[model samples]
Target: MTNNKTSEVPVQDPGADAVSESVIQLIRQHYTLDARRIRRIYAGLGSRNWVVYTPQETYFVKEFISSEDAQKGKRSIEVATHCITSGIASPSTVANRAGEHLTLLEDGGLALFSYVHSDEQIDKFSIDMMAAAGVNLADTHRALSRYTAPGEDETDEWLDMDVAEIVETVDEILGEISKLDQTSEFDEVSRRLLQDRKVQLANYSRLIEPIRILTRGVIHGDYGQKNLIVDDTQCLWVIDFGSADIFLPAYELGRAAFPPENFDHDDWLDRGLSMIKSYALRGALTRQNLVFCARAWLVQLLQSVYGVKQHYLKPHELQEDLDLFWLRRGKATATLFESLEEVEASIERIL
Candidate 1:
């Protein structure tokens, strides 16, 4: 939710001319509006997003980068439709003149949707807002409970990671870290954290057994403040279903609770529990689920570290700042993990 500005800014890509021409062509051919202006929206890690403004109405367009991702985009729209019919606040898809939800691009796919105007000030979310978000999340889960994907069979694989898979991932990350030259500060810190994560995973290996049996369903893959939008009428609309997949419900809850922006908040724990309690009122959230929440927090921390490691391996111009950022995040995550026991106890009382 950073760097979100809605102005008449040009697209960042150097090939903006060609891209805009193609998009304009799509709009003119498929829709009934004179495209007035278009500006890129800097949100989400996946997909190139743009806000297309017309004299009649505005639209949000997404251009997928891969065929598999395009398929997911199609599935996401279907999921959103189900959620909408179930009374969840989500965006409505804007199909082309051909009556198709997706426009197949050469490399991937494209889709247009009704633009949702929202406040991007996630850091300013009030306690009531947090609680509301929790309730909506539960509502989303309940609505998705009855969702059966088209052509879905036993052979369809969902994007879920079990404890065993997480453990294997830990080993792989550690091995990758060890192979790096330990000269730079980033390398040194990454190696140290990776080693510690290996130990932590070993200690908490037993917790995985209970987590595997928790409530599983279609969850908003990246549910957090970033994906939420407060519409003109103050209704919160959840967007960006690109990562939607079948997974433990607790994963979504935990992701919402441990967003990096909330790390420094004084009453984050209280607010997080309040959201959890609100969610429980609409859906099932047991003490066992709270345990998995703690585990989820740890996993998020490890994932952050792994992300930093990946950045270190890649060639980027902001290498200096990236290392500093990783160090700071590493320290914060380590500090949180140290106090996780106390955090878990407090969350337990709420249950």
Candidate 2:
């Protein structure tokens, strides 16, 4: 649940267009591909993306804005390739004419992927897809567990946090949001949520419990709505094996199954546990592996303020972005903090 790396590129991201003459030439020459049409799509931060159509088929293209992102994208491509070979339901990477995942560019880089079509949103929380999501995530973890990326020994996903420092950061952002003019809707909502979170942070310490037994491995970095597409048959297609190097099952399960939208549902806990239990059954995991989940997620929610910084502090850097996502996440964090005791008790009883 960590924030993305800070990119040092220009504010004018190359997210506008990829169908220019020179770019088309690079795509055709290196990958021997012709684009019938290219439409820009938002995949994630740090990339210019397009859902493209060719005379033959459809595909997705991602172009990174910086060298650092390009390199991480390459590694993720490697991991996705491995996932496909291991029988995971991920899109296959298309190599350029030179037989590499990336077609390197002057300022950034581009990569192509087979297209995935979906008829549903995970927001609907369809009964069939929830269980499928669990199995999909479990299978992904099982496959990545055996894979160690190039020049890597071991990876740990446990968050390193100081309670006081996080509280202070929260306080700082809250105070900053307080001084806003409140003319905009985001400013109004953010101010109220910050005030609520400040009160909740006082008791957040009660949720803390120390742990020693830890398990860590490669993780599917982003398993949320953006990457998970439910096709017409309702099979969960996991995509975009992000630059995630390490993860803990407890944190990720809470992150994936207990989405922000689920908090509003009356049976949120049941749905979350259903997904987690399904994952555990498919992956053959034990109770101890998931025991610390409540604490793991609690700490993460406490640390979340990426939205605050993006909205209130660095507004200039903002583009056509996921504004609703940040607000939903902030609201969910408040709900969880208010219900910490029930959340922890439920996880303990079930797991």
User: How well does each candidate superpose onto the true structure, as a TM-score?
Assistant: 0.80, 0.85
- What CA root-mean-square deviation does each model show from the true structure? 4.4, 5.6
Q: What lDDT tens digits, residue by residue, belong to model 1 across residues 228-251?
A: 888756688877764346677786
Best by TM-score: 2
Candidate 1 global TM-score: 0.80
The sequence of per-residue lDDT tens digits that candidate 2 reaches over residues 1-351 is: 011332222213465343443445566778877765555664478776766566898877787888888987888888888888888877788889999888777777999888877764344465455667778888888888777663332232233446567667767777786676655777778778777767766765555444235466667777765677767666667777865566566667778777887776887777777777677778545676665665566667766767566665575244335466678778778777777568767766765
Q: Which portions of model 2 miss their true places by more than 4 Å?
A: 1-23, 121-124, 150-158, 181-183, 203-206, 316-322, 348-351
Candidate 1 pairs with clashing backbones:
none
Q: What TM-score would you give candidate 2 relative to the actual structure?
A: 0.85
